[model samples]
Target: MLAVIQSSIREYPLKPQHLLPLALATVLIGCAPSPDEELNATLPQLSLKELLPQAVANEYCNPKLDSDLLYGIGYQLYNDDKPEQARSCLIMAAPTHDRALCYLASIAEQDSSKDSAERDRQAFGYMAYSAVKNDSCAEFGMFQNFTYGMRGQTPDIDLGLRWLERSARHGDADAQQTLVRLHSNKGNLPLAYSWAKVLDDQAQIDALKQRMNPQQLSEGEQGFEQLSKIVTSKDAVRKEAREENIAVYSANIHMEYPETFKGLSVAERHALMEQAVATVSARPEFSTRGQFYAYVIIAQQAQLKQTGVDVLQNPQIVELLSDTELEVSEAVKKADVILGQAAL
Candidate 1:
């Protein structure tokens, strides 16, 4: 019945006489719908997939222009596990929406096949374009690709640091946190504390403030409040990702393959560790992301324990054994020497 009325409405004549007859018929027959009702009734409660194009037509209308509606649809679709469809909305919005471009780049990176350098290049290009437009999320991504070399590139610490700083200035909490960790690691307590104050727990903030002079502490607090506005804004997709970093980043990173070298003899354990590291390091980009975290933290920790050394007392042992980027072969050799001496 709805379809028949819709067909009649679509095919209705354009003349005033025709509309007059329709109006009279609508008034005379109580069972019949007005033209507006016919059209509205045709619009059934369709799923997002069915409604998206119609919404695009209504809101976007032009193929060349970026649409906020399209950007939103793409973001939701991508989150909903529909990348193939999300690509459509995101690509349309990429002309103006940096977040959309970043998502497109990430999707390409995620969907790229083995030996697909062109695809990788395209993905990086998208990130570069988005980053140049001051997309904090894209800036952070580029920093990761260069710093960790986990996206088929060599690690360029200098370039990565520059981008990282840019990302932080743009109010990316991920970049801010990374900068804080890096500074603390390098013993640049002032710079670390300054940045950490902008992105830290109350305890960490208090500790950092204690390390600073009154003037520096005041400056740090002022800067923290200013950047905190950008960092905490819910509108930016990058901010959402930054909030998630606290819960998911460290927990999500794990060795691609198992480090099943435990319970084996020292030599056997050493060989297993070396093999795993070599295999992962040989790959330009990999699940391990250029880090041998599990081997050092878990497998090598066991060896250190067997030597009966207090891991807490020997800060040197902790420092030497805690490199994520250390080569597997080098790590095994170093561990044997250090743990062996500690046993004596």
Candidate 2:
């Protein structure tokens, strides 16, 4: 055990005159909450009334201006028609919101007096940050700015398309619609059909079908073939299955000896799963992860017991399942073929 001497500098005696200032300094050094750098330095030194109107300061620091609460207050201010104040509040809460940076970029766009190039650069920086943080809306914002050059940057079609693709993958219907239009107008039917099929924009897809010859349609189907790999991955399937509260199975390693594995003849199931995994191992991307492939094969096997095998759509994928996109897709296709033949 240790005893500590609580002493101030000996030169500064314990005078009443010094007590208040020391207490104030303690508050400044310790209790004050300022997530913003500028405000952080000065707010602690100022009286509560001087820092903010007494009520506002009290509420801003109510429980404490924690990250979540600061975001809430800033979000509320934005909804209350106080966008300018909201910007200040949200800036202090930067990089965390229901996509606040995009909102800030929009607000910044209205400052017509700022130099156009500089203003666009500022907005672009905010949007780019938000996009990489996986804000679907910000990704879409980045897509537009890049595609059209509206933010003073030159049009970057390839980069814009990549952003747009990510935004669509994140389930922004608007981004999907843009992809549909872009691919359709460019006569890239296969890519367009992929987008259309995802969104179930059947009427337009049907119209496009009428114009395609068999080769064009076949080529179109193949063009977007690689895209579905994400959903078919073991991780995606497990997440979707868990969210739906579906039954999932354990692999041999996951359980010492699960009843399910025993019920299906452990040796046979393991052999079939390995065989299916071997088919995908032919692909380089998935060849390296042995155990991961086994987990995916187990997912494919689970689906086979019910109906068809689609590792991505398997409601019975194991909880701890993970696999590469290449492995998962190949596993599903190969497993379906293997299991389908076994059932027959």
Using lDDT as the measure, which candidate wins?
1
| Tens-place lDDT digits, model 1, residues 307-327 | 533443455444554565676
TM-score of each: 0.45, 0.45
Candidate 2 residues 282-344, lDDT tens each? 544343444354554555355548645555343333222334444444544555565456557
Candidate 1: how many backbone clashes? Answer: 0
Give the backbone clash total of model 2. 1
lDDT scores of the candidates, listed in order:
0.53, 0.51
Candidate 2, superposed: residue stretches over 4 Å from native: 1-80, 223-225, 231-344
